[model samples]
Target: MSANLESVTDTADLAQSLREVFGRAQRALREQSGRFGLTPSQAEALGYVLRDGPLTITALAKRQSVRSQSMGATVGVLLEQELVTVTPDPSDGRQKVVTVTEKARALVAKGRNARTDWFAKQLDTLSPGELRTLAEAQKLLGRIFP
Candidate 1:
């Protein structure tokens, strides 16, 4: 095979590997969140707001790569669920900020704990050699992503 062809093939293989790895992790988290009656997107949004509260819907839309209207709808669902609260911006009454409530905070914490425990159990099933390789790959991924 040509050198360029081989290089392209290697890159594609690596990309697919990364995609599968990330997708599996996401699915696990999504499954855990679903147990709490939250969709993956809703769980993700809750986690974000829990970590960075008092964010505007527009700001969240930018972060989540959705239109403001879409994010507003998402936030509205959280609002209805009593997971978040919207208050008028102190600086601009015309604008409002979304913040997580105590209940949602507990929910996020529980979800995180569940995910961590689940992954830990899964890792325990791996052989030591496999675990070492996984750890090394994670380090490499950190460098590549960071």
Candidate 2:
């Protein structure tokens, strides 16, 4: 094969591998959140609020690529669970902002700790050299992502 074609093929394989690994990791973390009785959409919306501060249902819907009504239903579940609070936007009374509640923070922290504990156990099985290589690979991944 030509060198250029070979490089493209290798990149495509690597992209697929990364996607599969990320998907599996997401599933594993999702399982941890499931313990809190949260659906994937609810958990994802909560995560976005936690990470990005308060946002409107429209904003969240745009971020998630879902419809406003769909996001409203997801936020409704979060509100019902007391995981989020909705208040009128100070600057725009016509729109409401969704904010994560303290209860949601606690749940997120617990879920994070659970996932970290599980990951740490898996890391314990790796040799020191393997760990170092993994760390370097993580840095490369960061460059690709960031």
Predicted structure with the largest TM-score when compared to the true one:
2
At residue 66, candidate 2 shows an lDDT of 100
List the candidate 1 regions with Cα displacement exceeding 4 Å: 61-73
What tens-digit string does per-residue lDDT give for candidate 1 at 1-146?
69999999999998999899899988877676464777767767777888886888878888888988988899999999999999988888877799999998787778778888888998999999999999999899899899
Q: lDDT of all the models against the reference?
A: 0.85, 0.90
Error of 1 at 73 (Å): 4.6
Clashing pairs in 2: none
Task: Give me the runs in candidate 2 sitting further than 4 Å from their true place.
Answer: none
Looking at model 2, residue 145 earns an lDDT score of: 91
30-128: candidate 2 lDDT, tens digit per residue: 675464887767778999999999999999999999999999999999999999999999998988899999999998888889888888888999999
Question: After best superposition, candidate 1 residue 110: deviation in angstroms?
Answer: 0.7
> All candidates' TM-scores?
0.79, 0.85
